[model samples]
Target: MFWGDLHVHTAYSLDAYGFGTLRTPAEAYRFAKGDAVGSPAGDVQLDRPLDFMAVTDHAEWLDLMYTCTDPRMSAHPYCVKLRNQSTQETGGTVFRDFVNPTITQAQPAKADVCTDDPSACDDALLSQWERMQQQTNAANDPCTFTALNGFEWSATPNYSHTHRNIIFAGDNVTPTPVDYIRFPEIDQLYSQLEAGCRAEDGCDAITIAHNMNMGDGKSFDVETESERTLALRTRYERLVEITQEKGTSECLPDYTHRESLGECGYETYITSHSRQKPLADFEEEEWERMRSSYARGLLRRGLLTYANRQDAEGNPLQVGFIGSTDSHTGLGGYVEEDQWQGTVFGIGNFERNMSRMGFNPGGLVAVWAEQNTREGIFSALKNRETYATSGPRIALRFDAAKVGEVPACKAGGALAPIAGGTPMGSTLPEASKAAVFRIAVTGDKAPLEKIEIIKGTLKGESYEESVIPVWQSDKGEANACVIWSDTEFEPAAPTYWYARVTEVPTPRWSSYICQEAGRCEEFPDADVKIQEHAWASPIWHLPTR
Candidate 1:
């Protein structure tokens, strides 16, 4: 399996550039290849080289930044305002003025910047896009590393984040990346991709939806939509980012306490759209809306709603899972807990007691591909044969087979699919009475604690979920495998099951920072040690098909 990061940003994103990241697209790829790249803080590098990466800068800011940063336009008043007032070191009055009301609020381009020439604005955006494409292609090494083409389409309305990262399979990409400036709603972005990428042969792309925890219920709003719309959405969005710098979108404890007890209460920061208040302080309806903002919650809600929405492809709700760092520092796969730098460290001076309290070191994506080439990695992603890890490069394989079938072990200790069975992120054939699931995990450095099989069943628009502990290490076993049978499985129900592997308690990134700074007592509740874990994509059983 090859480890990689598909979501990252460079200085081309004006927001990141304005904040402090100076690393260019080439520098970002260099950093991911285990090279030391200069950060605003200092020289930063990942301990290990990533096999594949995609530098997804913000698409909305490409033109405005290109227009302002052009040497020819150096003396223009608009460019001067961008350089002088917007950058954090200078004053940041203009950056705040630009980002909030215009970008996150999802408004039109600033009139002063775009001016009267709409064609010129389009030209500038296309120029930046082409430059990014060229740089990505140049950095790609089918012999050494795979650099995929991608960009972020950020849509944050009313402080809610409903964003998507567009990743192309190969050189055949859209002439222009669809951005929120033109496609305000998420549906428009998908339609544009259909028209741009899929219109031409040999061109294919998929968008990874992320930060559903902060999406304020708009990230996966499939309710009241048509069947064809669901099919289209399922076709375009094959993966969901399960964990990231913001927090775990897998599940939160607060929702678990009241609803599904999925044991998902770890690193759950930034829970609300309005403020940094806890879920207890939120209104009942607003708190209820949070069910749509988590991965597990999305699965549960999918069971409730997507019963009849299965397309010719499969259920619209079944999505592959992956993780990545939304790091603006242009540092890909920099997810080590020991070598820590805050996400928005302008000069490495992160006030941990303040905004940094909610953030972590981010995560990585692991794909089981045939080779280390772009075609290989993108094929793995499209096939939904991928898993996500929280910093550690834990190896995992989850598979399901009929009760009488036997699971095999591959050469690399990975679990091989049974003769007539399905693997993770796949749909199973109709079962007889029960199904046996084989789960294999190999922890990195840390010892294993437990492996849980979270199962959810749909019965006429209402669902029930349970967490079944399949295996737990008594000794300090960092590696183990188990074939657990669901004796109580119901053949009539449409269900989904996935594996969650937890490690022994270890210090969080905040705890490491506090230990180094000798400020453990300063942030009492926030700096507690955490159990880092990995999540495999779900295997589903759609009975109606």
Candidate 2:
């Protein structure tokens, strides 16, 4: 298996650049390859080199700030504003008054910037796209390190985060990125990508949604959409980011109570944001809406939607899970708590350090592939043969089959016969005997806590769920495996099973910050210690009629 981080930003992004990032795409790739890079906090480097990485800068104003900063382009009015207001106070105002309005509303800048010609704007964007592709090509090595070309489509409608990172399989990418400035709606972005990349020969792309916790319940909305819309979504968007620098979107604290699970909350940044104050104090309907903004909730919803709508190939829609660092400082795969760096560029002083404290070191993506090349890694992602981790390099595998047959080791494998079952991310076949699920885990940084097999089954219009603790380490073993059989299995019901591996408690990122300032008592409920964990993609068992 090869470990990688697919979502990251460099100085090309206007927000990262305006905040303080000075690293380029080349610098980001170098940092991912284990080279030390300069940060505002200090020198930053990954503890280990990643097999692959992608620098997905925001597509809204790709390289616009860098272009405007050039002396030759100072004739433009926007360039003049960027040159005049370089301070943090004035920069924030500039972002609110000028940048935010232009991108969010899809409004063009003053005619002076474009000089009354629309193609001039397109030319500037195309130039930046070419430059980005060139840098990515220069850093890509076939077997040593893979650098995939990608960009982020920043579609934050009404201040709600509905963002996606677009990753291409190879160096062959679209000539221009489809940003929200042109495609205001998420479906429109998918349509443009289908025309530009997916339909073209030898070019393919996938969109991974991230930061759903901040979406205010609109991130996973599929209630009243048509069959065609669902088909299009399932075709391009196959994975959702389960964890990131923003927060873990796996499950919510309140929703876990409804599901009869233990405390599953950790590093929740959504509730801490000022914009989410209304959501944090939700009354009735709004509180219920919170359930739709998490990974587990979306999986349940996807099962319902797939049962109703079939794709073009006549297969049910399934979504896999992955994690990324979402680092804005051009440091990919830098997850060490002690050697942490700030996400925003200009926030490093004592007072500004509080802004950085809320963010964790971030997560990593693990793909079961044969080689470290782009083809091998991209295939693993497209097939849903992947897992996620909250910084630790924990190895996990889940498989299911008949009681007497040998279980397959890979995820997303289809069931062959009634006697042999499927793997995770796949549908199970009809069987007479009970299905046996095998789970194996190997921990590196900490000892094992407990392994849970969470099962969600749908009956009629409602759903029933349970978290079965199948295995626990009595001796705190680093490696363990369990084979669990559902003796009360109902072959007529539709069910999904996924595994969650937890580690022994360790100091969280906030704990380190408080220890340095000698103010551990100030933040009493700040969750100083946490148990790092990993979640594998789910395997489904549909009713065989």
Candidate 3:
């Protein structure tokens, strides 16, 4: 399977400055092609190249970094006069605020192209946008690389958290992103984009929600914090990023206090590198303290829905998960050995240092697709046939049926059962009084080991559950299958089930190489004793009456 890091930032993003590498659109594409870290001008290369990369720099002050750099643009007498500092430092002043400046500061200072005229903004901005698009298209060589046009929409509702990354599939067409839409609310942005796409042809876009842990307890809510019923959320947001370079979005210890130990403490949210009151600060161990609360919240919201009646549409708001590295550096440096080369902090530069550059080589995105092409990859993401990793591409397959049931599907052959079976993230209908879950575990060709199935239930008003060791396949085959039955399931138990496939302990990238071996020595603090391979089944909930 081919690998792709869907979320990334470029120099166009204000905060990306001095974070080791500051790459332009063209430079970002080259960095991906070489599978390397650092800007086009820097020295490090990635251990493994990504098949595809999306330069999703922020859209708030899109391309401000480049515009401010051109003397012809920034040195306009009007622009120079408005600045308290020297004209050369205007860019830093505009972007370096403790909190990003609002849109009022976005207009040109003069009256003409060279004199701070609003039209000048168009000249510099439009050229930069085209440059970004051209570079993305230039890097698309199907056999080796795919470059996607994407940008992050910063939507902090009343300064709370509600950010999303918007990505596009085809480079053939694009909208002349308007200035009035600058920093609009998330719902409005979604409406604008959806309307724009329908006006054109073959334009497909998807938004991935991120940094939600910082949403102050409202990121995953069914309704907007303002009590607005955002019907478009169900239509626009197709997936949730559950893991990233800074932390994992899986259940936190405190959120899942009842079943908090095993997979709870893996990692937390990505605090920005700046020490000046991190843009979004919270206690380091907050994940532990908030785990149970979060899970309870999820259950509370989920249970409110009735058995048959749905939302405005016949469909329910499906809460599915996927993972990605919110890497400021263009590469998603997920592997420990390659972490130093793939992330921003890994760049050997002292002057560009920031506290948030506290590097942790964590997380990757995995999808179950028919092939490694653009269409196939996009389909997996849209259908939620994807899983995130703390960084190993472990293969996991799961199916549920009655105790005596066996699928006719197999991985090989023209009409093999694999083609007819449901993979992880799929629901199994009730076949009998009890459901017998079957799973197949395969290590990332690294090691074979054990598997876990995390189950939850609502006993009336309270929810109870357990992570059962359903499958314990040996380290014998390249892959192994396990069958287990839970005849004890009560007919009245309000239940939901999911699987976690894991690999046997294996050598981490650090274990195989040391500093003297011309590689970074210590595995990142973010690196944990990972079992290489893991699979998470979709939370199969029976239904709420």
Error of 3 at 25 (Å): 3.2
| lDDT (Cα, tens digit) per residue for candidate 2, span 1-545 | 77889888887777666665668898999999999877666776677899899999888876464357521354666777765664443557656755676565676433456666666567778887887899898999988898999999887766777888999999878778888887888778878887888545788888888887777667555766656665677777877888998888887645325433245566666542226453335555554565566777787776676555433322323667788999878888988665664456334443445545666778888887778888998887877777888889888777676657765432223312223455555656645455678877778678888899888777766777778898886656677677788776777666778888888888886677666767768765443688888888787776642
Per residue, candidate 3 scores C-alpha lDDT tens digits across 74-193 of 654433433333222243454444114432233322223244355656666676667678877788776567677777776554444456777676674346443323535565666766
Evaluated at residue 9, the lDDT of candidate 3 is 74
Residue pairs in candidate 2 whose N, alpha carbon or C atoms collide under 3 angstroms: none
TM-scores for all candidates: the values are 0.93, 0.90, 0.75
What lDDT score goes with residue 230 in model 3? 40
lDDT (C-alpha, whole model) for all candidates: 0.78, 0.73, 0.53
Descending-lDDT candidate ranking: 1, 2, 3
| Ranking of all candidate structures by their TM-score, best first | 1, 2, 3
Error of 1 at 346 (Å): 5.1
Off by over 4 Å in 1: 70-73, 86-95, 253-262, 309-313, 345-347, 352-354, 408-420, 431-433, 525-527
- lDDT over C-alpha atoms for residue 190 of model 2: 77
C-alpha lDDT of residue 130 in model 1: 92
For residues 1-545, could you state the per-residue lDDT of candidate 1 as single tens digits?
A: 89999899987887777775667898888888889876645777777899999999988888877787742354567777767664445535655676666666677544576666667768888898998999899999995899999999988888788889999999899989888877888778888888889735788999898988788777677776666667678898888999998888887544436444347666776557734676556666776687565787777766656565554345566788999988877888988877766776433654632346788878899987889998999988988888888889998988887557767644237555566777788877765567788888878988989999999897666678888998887665778788888887778888889999999888777677667777778767556788888999988777763
